[model samples]
Target: MGIVLNQSLKNTIITYLGFGIGAINTLYLYPFFLGTVFYALTNYILSWANIIMPLLAFGMQNTLVKFYTQYKTEEERSRFLSFTVLIPLLLCIPLVLIGLFFFEPISLYLSKENPVVKDYLWLIPFIGLSMAYFEIFYAWARVHMHSVFGNFVKEVGLRLFSLFALIGVYYEWISVVEFIYVTAIIYFLACIITMLYAFHIKKPVFQFSIPQNVKDVLVYTFFIILSGSVAVMLLDIDKIMLNQYIKIENIAYYSVATYIASVIAVPSRAMHQITYPITAKLMHENKHDELNDLYKKTSINLQVVGGFVMLCIFVNINQLYVMVPKEYSGGILVVFLIGISKYFDLILGNNNAIIFNSKYYRMVLFLGLLLVFLTVGLNMFFIPRFAITGTAVATLLSITLYSLAKLLFVVKRMHLYPFTHQTLYSLAITFGIFLSFYFWEFPFSPIISIGLKSALVTLLYVYINYKFVISIEINQALDLVLKKLKIRL
Candidate 1:
């Protein structure tokens, strides 16, 4: 817990900084400078790349984490790392070749509704390959307990680069088409930097020998591909499907809404970076007691933090829309629906880590694949009628069912749960604060109003949670801050 909290705090700060830059890019700079069509194209390209990343990497990133600590010697570990890295590199050859062979037909299908996507179709696999190696190297660093730098590079570095690219578009130094190309280069650059840092952490021996547990590793990697694909598809599939039914520019609106709601996930994202390796280690050792304890702590702590962000976003969503272009404001319902789904996901804490590292991962993978089908079906039904908002509806229902299944599986199979009585208290407090603050708006400008109301919501939410001792971990941290400020509670 000590190391978890320490690095989690650092990662949280870094993730939010990245999200801040990203929020600026997604909400204002991209839409205002690039126009909604190209903005949607940028998002569409990246989303498809993300969907393709898992298949390209052959699930080596997760396999590395789940197996790294199991080896007994440095030579064996080196062999395993060699296998993880080299397999993904070798697999990309055939995938890329196949993609090139079918390129025109694939491009035609994707750009049916909007031909703006045709020229950019080549970029997806290039970026996906970059994203695949980035995760493999990122997991390489994480197993060595060196996640903060990788997290910074991943969270801050990419978005910071995008910020500069978008600014170049605004200043007429680069055209929007060049901005799209630059975005692909940025991802590849991030992958190279992370690989270098990982090498610095522990210089690889690059052994060509197969690992002793090669069969087990391969099987796990196979299922993890399905698992990873399921999770990524849940997050980005809506945007991809939105392209099929609606105008490309409308995805820009959905992207804005989803990005705003995604801020609530910062805590979970931060903690998962550190907790994942720890969870893997614990499950490997058969330390169920300690694993369950970590699970509960992560659950409550994330809910407390994530709930506040959700409340702030929900209450101030209207004010937020005021600052963006009017066309983008149509995504308010998308924000609310996606925000609730993300908050549900946030409270699950280490549920994903627990399942992915466990022996029953195959069962959950089957369930996840089924749910992906359900998500696609729901989108097919909803999108033709309601457009982007309907996409949000499909996402909300699919993800809620998926989350509930994961939660129940952990409880029924492992006999471990991530909630306490304090969970209910946190929910009640969240609703109370939301109701009190949601109905009115400040008389000032949008930025000032958001600042004033967010400050008030923060104070009241913190005071109530701290007053009732909702989470001991949170209260202890709050005590430290208050002590430093010489303030009494």
Candidate 2:
């Protein structure tokens, strides 16, 4: 718990910094600097890449995390690592060949509705290939408990580079077309850096020998591909589908709303980095008691953190939208629906890590595939009728169903639950704070209004949680901060 707390806190700060930069890029730079067409194109390209990344990598990233600890000898570990690293290339080569043979047909299919996407079709696979290797290397680093640096490069470095690229577009130093190409280059660069850092942590002793548990390893990897694909599909498929059903520019509007709502997942994202490997190791050791304890602690702590974020977003949504362009103001409902969905995901804590590392993973993958179909079905039914708002509704429905299924499976099979009495208390407090602050407004600019309201909500929320000791872990964290500042709570 000590290491988890220290590293999660550090990772949270870094993740929030990354999101802060992303907020600027998503809200101001993309919409204001780049026109909606270019902004939507950029977002669409990246979303396409994200959806394809798992297939390109062939699930090696997750396989590495799940199996890295099972090997006992250095030679065995080397063989496993070597095999996982090369497996993706095998998948990548075939994919590239297919893309080459079918490029025209594929481009026409994607761009029939939005002709702007035709020119950028090549960027999708190229960026997806880069993103695939980035995750492969990131998982390599995570297994060594060296996640912060990789997290920084992934979360902060890419956004920082994008910020520069957008500035170039703004100043006319680079054309929008060049900026699009530069985006792919940025992902490839990040991949190279992460691979290098991973090697620095522990250089792989390349071995072509087969692992002892090759059968199990291969089986797990196969199922993980589905799992990884399902997860990515849930997150990015809406953007991709939106490009199909509506004008490309509407994606830019939806992207802004989704990005704002995504802040709710930051705490879960940060905590999962360290907790993932820890969870894997614990499950491998069959330490159910400790794993159960971790499950509850993470759930409550994340709820406390993520719930506050949702509260702030729901309360300040109007002011936040005022800062963006009027064209994007239509995504208010998108924010609320997706924000609640993400908050639900956060409170489940490291449920994902636990399931992915456990034997029940294959069953979850089956469920995931069904939900993927459901998501597409819902999107197809809703998007043409309601446009961007309908897409959000579809996402909300799919994620809610998916999350509930996962929660139930974990409870029934693993006999572990993330909720406690404090779970209900946390929800009640969140509702109370939101209702109290949703209508409250300040006579100031959007920025100042957000700041004042956020500060008030945060102070009140934290003080009440601390007073009740909703989570001993959170309370202890607050106590540590106060003591460091020579102040008493």
Candidate 3:
């Protein structure tokens, strides 16, 4: 837990900083600077790119994390790394060729509701390829137990560049069309930088020979690709589907609301970077006891942190919406719906890492694939009738069902459960704080009101959790921070 706490904290800070920049861009810059039409176009292209990213990389990112620890000899490790890296590059060729071959009809289909997307069809695969390699390299870093730099590049670097691009658009230095292309270039550069940083972490041996367990590697990669695609599709498919049913501008609305809700996920994302490799190592070593301990700890700690963020978002949601445009305010319901779904997923902690690394992964992958169909079916049925609100409902239901299944599978197969008494206490505290704060507001500007209310909420929440000692790990963390600041608890 030492390295987990160390790196997870760093990653958490980096992710929120990224999300902070993203908040500004999503809430203010993208909407106000580019207008709704082009803003939606930007999100539409990126969402499609994200959906296709797993196939392009061939799931090497997750495959590396899962299998990297099992090999004994350095030679074998190098060979496996080579296999994970090169195979994805090789397999991407045919996928790109297929896209190019059917480019026209694909573009026509996607651009049905919004013709603006037709012009940027090329960026979809291009950006997806970039995202694929970025994750591959990021996994490369993670396997070495050095996730901070790669995480910084992913979380902070990309959003920072996008912020500058938005400024360029504001200054008339770049047209919105040019800004769109620039965003693709930003992703491409991020991929390159992460690759170099990965190489620096551990100089590549670049073995051309195949790993001894090529069969296992290939098989796992195949299942992982489908599963990875299922997960990404679940997250981004709402945006893509929105393009088909609602106007393109509605996606901009949906994106902003979802982005706000997604801030609740930062702690989970941060912890997973390191916990993933750790979970794989524990599973590979068959250390069930330690794995169960990790499962419980990650569950409670993430619940505590994620629940805090959710509380802040829920209480301040109305005030938060006041800052956005009038049209975008329709997503208020979308925030609560998506935020609850995400919080449920969050409290499950390392449930994903545990399942993906375990022997029962094949069954879970099938379940995930079926859920993908369910999500699409729900989106199709709901989006036309209810617009973005319907899409949010579909997302909430699908994600809740998916998360619940994973939780039950872990409990049944491994006899491992993440919830403890702390979990219940955390939930109780979150509800108490939310109820107390939700109806209260500062009679000030949106920014000042949010700050004042959030401060009071944070102090109250932290005091109660600290007093109860809901998690020893969290209490220890608080002690360190308070000690550093020369304060006594």
After superposing candidate 1, which stretches have Cα over 4 Å from the reference? none
Name model 3 segments beyond 4 Å from true.
Answer: none
Please provide, for model 2 over 1-489, each residue's C-alpha lDDT reduced to its tens digit, 9 standing for 90 to 100: 998998899999999999999999998999999889999999999999999999999999999999999999888888988998887887688789988999999899999899989998898999999999999999999999988998999889999999999999989999989999999999999999999999999898887677889899989989989899999999999999998888999999999999999999999999999999999999999999999999999999999999998998999999999989999999999999999999999999899999999999999999999999999999999999999999999999999999999999999999988999999999999999999999879999999999999999999999999998999998888888899999876
Tens digit per residue, CA lDDT, model 1, 306-399: 9999999999999999989998878999999999999999999899999999989999999999999999999999999999999999999999
Q: Rank the candidates by lDDT, best first.
A: 1, 2, 3
* TM-scores, each model vs. reference: 0.99, 0.99, 0.99
Give the count of colliding residue pairs in each prediction. Answer: 0, 0, 0
* TM-score-best of 1 and 3: 1
Compared with the true structure, all predictions reach lDDT values of 0.95, 0.94, 0.93
Return the top candidate by lDDT: 1
- Stronger candidate by lDDT (1 vs 2): 1
- Give candidate 1's whole-model lDDT: 0.95
User: Which whole-number lDDT from 0 to 100 does residue 177 have in model 2?
Assistant: 90
